[model samples]
Target: MSRTFFTSDHHFGHKNIIDFESRPFSGVEEMNAAMIESWNSVVAKEDKVFHLGDFSFLNRDKTRAIVERLHGYKVLILGNHDRGRSRGWWLDAGFDEVSEHPIVYQGFFFLSHEPMYMNKHMPYVNVHGHIHGQKYEGKSYFNVSVEHWEYKPVPFEQIRDSVAADEEQ
Candidate 1:
């Protein structure tokens, strides 16, 4: 059976990201390789990944190559950087599906590329990225950004446990 996973902001091949974000890797290659290795460590081939956004800064061919190396049935939730691009281009790169807006999955969680703004009255927890390592005090909001997750995709169990812990408080 295939498990589910979530993550965002890999920014592969984007050398400036190291300086901009102060990532610990020596350079782009190390950053990308570490992320790839980290991802593969937890996510198996049959898993399904909901990649929230800002996946890579690489070109078409590079993007295709990177996507091919990743494990999972990847679905993309397009972000600011992903906008104005042809959906077919991303599809051709190996994403099984691409969605532009927040999607409610399994009727339990709201998903978005940016941290979704919500009031205390919302019914479901929001799972999002793009804020990088920024913290959201509310238990209802969970971030899966690479910066927060050590450059790896978060397993479903982690999210589930997080949600449960949030609910307890």
Candidate 2:
């Protein structure tokens, strides 16, 4: 059966991101290859992946090539950096869908590239990316930045369980 996954802030082909995020890879090439392998390790071709944003900093051709190689029906929610390109540009780059704004998913989850405002009193949980290694406090927010997930996509069930556990507390 196909599964759903979430991830963001890949910054692929952005050499400076290695130092900025304190990523372990020696270079952009290594980081890109390792992330590709890690993504494919858990995501099958039939799976669906929601990429929160900042997918890449490479040129169109390079970015498209990387996106084409990943395993999933890809969806991209525009991030701060991603605004440099148009939605149609992202579509041509291989994403199956593109959203310029945060979207409500599964009724209660708010999906966005940047974390949305949330509180315990609120019914919706924010699932987002963009801060990289940093995270907001509270169970109402879930950060799926690649740095937080060991450079791989996280299954939606994992996010669901985390929220459920937090709600119990």
Candidate 3:
């Protein structure tokens, strides 16, 4: 069976990555290339990847090019930055969804942006992006954290252990 992965917040084409605290790249293109490398390193052609949002700083055509270069069947959870251009770009790129809210997959809640509050939640864990740098740390009602531009999936099981460790400390 193919693996299902989740990640987000790769602001490709944003030139000030090094200006940010936790971002390591010196330029946008460098950052974009690095993200692509990281993504392709682990994701296989047959895998399904859930991208939580803030996909690229590139426009629609560039976005399609970048998406095409990557491996996997992508599912987009649209972020605030994902406005304008063409909605068809997303659909044609093989994204299964492009909504703003939660999408369930294999008993997990997928979101592009973070939830406002988690007063009442579901049994499965919630995975999201939007926050980057050191801001990606910490705990919430949701049980997962796949934020930042690292472009790697953090499984629900791993996140559960992270949360448990955080609670113990």
TM-score of each: 0.96, 0.98, 0.76
What C-alpha lDDT do the candidate models reach, one value each? 0.88, 0.94, 0.63
Rank list by lDDT = 2, 1, 3
**131-151: candidate 3 lDDT, tens digit per residue:** 554353335434222334355
Error of 2 at 162 (Å): 0.7
Model 3 misplacement above 4 A:
93-96, 108-110, 120-124, 134-149, 155-157, 160-169
Off by over 4 Å in 1: none
Sorted on TM-score, best first, the list reads: 2, 1, 3
Q: Encode model 2's per-residue lDDT on 1-169: one tens digit a residue.
A: 9999999999999999999989999999999999999999999999999999999898888989999999999999999999989999999888899999998999999999988878669988999998999999998899999999889999999999999999898
Q: Where does candidate 1 have its weakest 10-residue lDDT segment?
A: 79-88
Point out the higher-scoring one by lDDT: 2 or 3.
2
**Which is better, 1 or 3, measured by TM-score?**
1
Q: Cα lDDT for residue 141, model 3?
A: 36
